[model samples]
Target: MARNKNRTEVKNYKKKKLTVSTSEESPAKKKKMSPKDPEDPDDALSKVESPEMKDLEDLTPEEQRKRERKLKKERKKEEKRLKRESAIDDDDEEEKPSKPSVCELSLQYLKSWSEKRKDWKFQKTRQIWLLQNMYDQEKISDDYFPILLEYLEGLKGSARDTTVKQAEDLMKEYDKSEAKAEADVQKMSRIREVLQLLS
Candidate 1:
């Protein structure tokens, strides 16, 4: 009887531990990883490894071609799913999306303009600018504007006017040891060099 009681106590203890640990996981995570279907090695391997890759493999060859054709349509949806998941993970810290002031938005839009890069040209820049203006006129709130600004700060512009403006801005604030001064000047010159290639 004592041995049986001890065995029962150990079993209960193990169950308690498992429950405690599992409680931290999500319901989606609770779903068992489905075994790789042997008939589809790619699918099986992907499932055991990367679900994203597996999902891609699950499609028939013909369906895959169709899938590629519609990638543009699906890109936004995939991005939204990732964004939602990221937002969920960031629940510990509440994030407040800041609307860019008109001046800030204009500055950002101008900064994104490229005049001569292989992929980015004046035409595309103008299109984006027009789109931005239309969005503003339509009173469409851009929650991603600030995020866009972060990327814009890193993009290389391809126009002389924009390059010169960027350099002048750098020259103006070159002296004040605010933050990342040397890096700022270097980045500005790099942008200028890229723009110079257009000429």
Candidate 2:
């Protein structure tokens, strides 16, 4: 059997493996080393300030520290103001919804109908909304109350009955309270005015 020369491993007697010991430092290694003082006043690294505060370098050390502190406080205050403004904007967006309420839609429809009654078709939902919200001054303003009452002239079925029922009830309340309090007298008279107009 022939021995393959490629399979045989050759060891060089001249070559040697080098191992570094932790105790020795290599001459090839060069590094800058310095001692850190915890209380050194002239320490550049310890006295480093923000880029914006670099302009204050010409001031006295005490003045520089004070200016830096003042600048930091002003920066934080401005940030807080911006945050508050953004929060208020978000709140406003949340409070004021994009879509109008049923009352608004009802009022819009009523106004359109009032302007062009022949062109504008009647909507049951708007009629019902007007009937429901007519009593509340907050929901239906005094300016539009008369118009809503006029619109109610064409109301029929249970809706018309309900309005009469509510109007009679309001009248009773008004007459009873007339001697005691005259606060809602104007409110009751609004319904009465409509009844008079209808009659």
Candidate 3:
């Protein structure tokens, strides 16, 4: 391990003896931390060998049982903390109000025209939606159907006539079907209502 090759010549000479005073402890012995020294938690741990730090095989049966109980308690405490966190998250989600989409907002806006007619201005897209879905029982709820009828009082010439013609044709087509479904019967009733309103 010597860095210089020529340094091997000194190996033949006898090694110098190191003298130790009888008052001092042996160099190989471990030193105890003094009370006056700066306190270090790890230094304290190093001085005192803890029984809990020993291997499982070195532990007594009672000590092993105590350790097992401590581990079980820690696991149960962690599970309880996780359960509390998830419960808080679920409560937060329940408290939050869901925002309505653009389509639903538009429909609600049109419905509000009954109360605020001064706010009513012609929207071609909304008029088109009324013409397309006015007669469908599924698309138009019964509560909103009459409201939409009042709204259509504003519709002039062709759109009004088209709505009437469409209702008549759908009603005739539905009447011809011998084995009508419950949903079709519902639609036929709504078409009759539409024809009565617009015709």
lDDT of 1 by residue, 53-128 (tens): 3443655566445544554344455558889999888874886787976655544444454322454434455434
Top TM-score prediction, candidate number:
3
Query: Per-candidate TM vs. native?
Result: 0.19, 0.46, 0.47
The regions of model 2 sitting more than 4 angstroms off are 1-97, 178-183
Candidate RMSDs in order: 22.5, 19.3, 17.2
lDDT of 3 at 155: 72
lDDT (C-alpha) at residue 106 in model 3? 47
Model 1 residue 102 lDDT score:
60
Clashes of each: 0, 0, 0
TM-score head-to-head 1 vs 3, winner: 3
**Model 2, poorest ten-residue lDDT window?**
9-18
Which residue pairs show backbone clashes in model 2? none
Candidate lDDT values, in order: 0.48, 0.61, 0.62
Error of 1 at 152 (Å): 17
Per-residue lDDT tens digits for candidate 3, residues 46-154, read 4455322333234456654654465456556656988999999999878667697544654775776777778866677777876787666666677887788777767
